[model samples]
Target: MTDWKKIRAEFPALENWIFLNTATFGQLPKRATEAVACHFARRDRYACSDFMGWFEDADSVRATIARLIHAAADDIAFIPNACTGLSLMMGGMDWKPGDRIVTLEDEFPNHYYYPGYLAAQGVEFIETPFERFYDAINQRTRLVALSMVNYSTGFRPPLEEISGFLRERGVMLYLDGTQGLGALQLDISAIRPAMLSVDGYKWLLAPTGGGFIYVDSELRRHLRPNIIGWRSHRDWRNHENLHHGTPEFGTEAEKYEGGMLSFGPIYGMAASVEMMLEIGPEVIDERVMQLAGSVRDILRRAGGVLRADSDSLYISPVVTARFEEKDAGVLAHELKSRKVLVAARHGNLRVSPHFYNDETDLERFEAALKQVL
Candidate 1:
């Protein structure tokens, strides 16, 4: 049996406030923080001397990430952020004048700007409503980018259904999995996308600048890393023979890895992912949904609108609620003043519960909500 109460205590922020902002940035537990601190301490003593050891640690993180999503470690590459990952996919592509890319208008800006920048190259960028995405795909469409779970409304799209539709037409699927990876249960085999990227700071509870990109085995043959660095080679010690003609890069996604990575963030990410694996995603999902369900019920009774259907399979760890007469911003401030934490997105308050949160946190949020409403 999992001792959830003990797990909740691991996050120091929960002692002071009701933390419902994992959608924005997840509060790091003590284990993650200590791992980062230890890395820094070790770095001070052994800088270049222990370089290979740190690289090994980063590789371990890649392996842990692969296990979390059921992908091969070779397919996963450590990226600086989700935008860099998205840019890699966009840059690797050979665009034509009439080629189209479909994406949602409400998606986070990272999904928009890179592909949006390609508009000057005569690539037709189609920004459509989430519901109309399927209809937007045509023969001209070559790539479709989407957020696995929308950052604003906590809306988890039907990736499996959309991928099925795209498969028949040979359109590629790219997903920003930042908001959904750690909080929700994900099986990449079932919801296969050509590429999936994550900025681990938000839901994965890792330090900033730690992220990974996963390229499907089929897609790997067609795409190459747009930028290459010294570490891109299989043998990093080859200083004499730099290049003869075309330099040989690693066959896997490791070819995209740039210069030295920040050891603190990489080790921190490894520790956090290992912790999540120990707890089990199924246990975390159950706890999160249980808390979110209670919040939805209480808010509904008090005359609030649920942004997501309670019975929907797409209902993720996030719950967005709009009070009838209360402004979302005002309510958010009121809740904060009452020592409860939430974020205002669109016209609703986004309540995102991580596995560490408990019923007491929900009760505090409810009491604060009643006062504000």
Candidate 2:
């Protein structure tokens, strides 16, 4: 007995709105907010004192994230957002002229800009449908960038199948796990991607501006980040030493930590991720899929068209639907007027349910949508 109702009580916003837009932003849980407050309180009291404590908290959170993904703590690094995480990872790569990067069509734009930027440097960027990604990869492909789950259509790709195929050819896999990581069950260790980036705001139930990046250990050994600072050195504190020669950087992904981190957001994400871990990953997945299934049933009854096949092998916590004659943006606004929260992505009404959401919320959404329709 997980006491899901009690768990749902942790989020007070649900009392105000039927929140089904975990894709856009997950409501911050009380525990995470408290942790953030605690960090600010500490910072207010000690302006610059106990600097190592912040780093320790970051390391602790890093270890927690590693545990969540079944990776070594050394492989994880806290970042400002997934955008920077992707930019930092790919931007630092040793891309050569004529190298091709394969990404999905209609990604959330973070996946587009970097490869597009690299186009000026003679790097070829290819965008393909998720279903045809396997067919699009040719010999020139060096890295495959994609989201584990499509934010627009709640389209969870055949990640493992694709990863296995890429693994056979030694093509690096880069994943933006923002929409899939926390709400869904994924074994990062098993997938063994070269890089994975995630933001904590959505699905993870954390505050904004905090996220983590995972770089493969073997990749870390060979790749040198484009950006490095004082913190990049293993003995950064030894600057006051009388004589220091060549600086030795950390071999792990922590080397990319670069500089100071926002302790508040780190703590906030830690608290939220801990909550998910406490609830159990498999348990959360089951609850989310069950709710999403009910949402599909409701939309079907309301004469809304599902964006993807409900019976598809790949599905996610996100479900998108649209009335035949209704515009997704207008429908979203209509629902919001009634205190129902959903998102419009790629001209579809996207509703993402989490473990804490229950039947009451779903029923409210069904009634509101039916009345609107």
Taking all chains together, each candidate's TM-score versus the true structure is 0.95, 0.96
The candidate that wins on TM-score is 2
Q: What is the C-alpha RMSD of each candidate to the true structure, in Å?
A: 1.8, 1.7
Query: In model 1, what are the clashing residue pairs, if there are any?
Result: none
- Ten residues in sequence with the least summed lDDT for candidate 1: 237-246
Q: Can you tell me which runs of candidate 1 are displaced by over 4 Å?
A: 237-246, 310-314
Model 2 per-residue lDDT tens digits across residues 1-373? 9899899989999889999999999889899999999888887799858777788778889889988889989999888889887888788888889999998887779989989999988999999986788888889899998898888877777888889999998899999999978888878878889989999899988889889999999889877775666677787755465225555777878888777777788999999999999999888888889999998888888888886554484356888887778888988999999999998987888889888789999999999998777
How high is the lDDT of residue 294 in model 2?
92
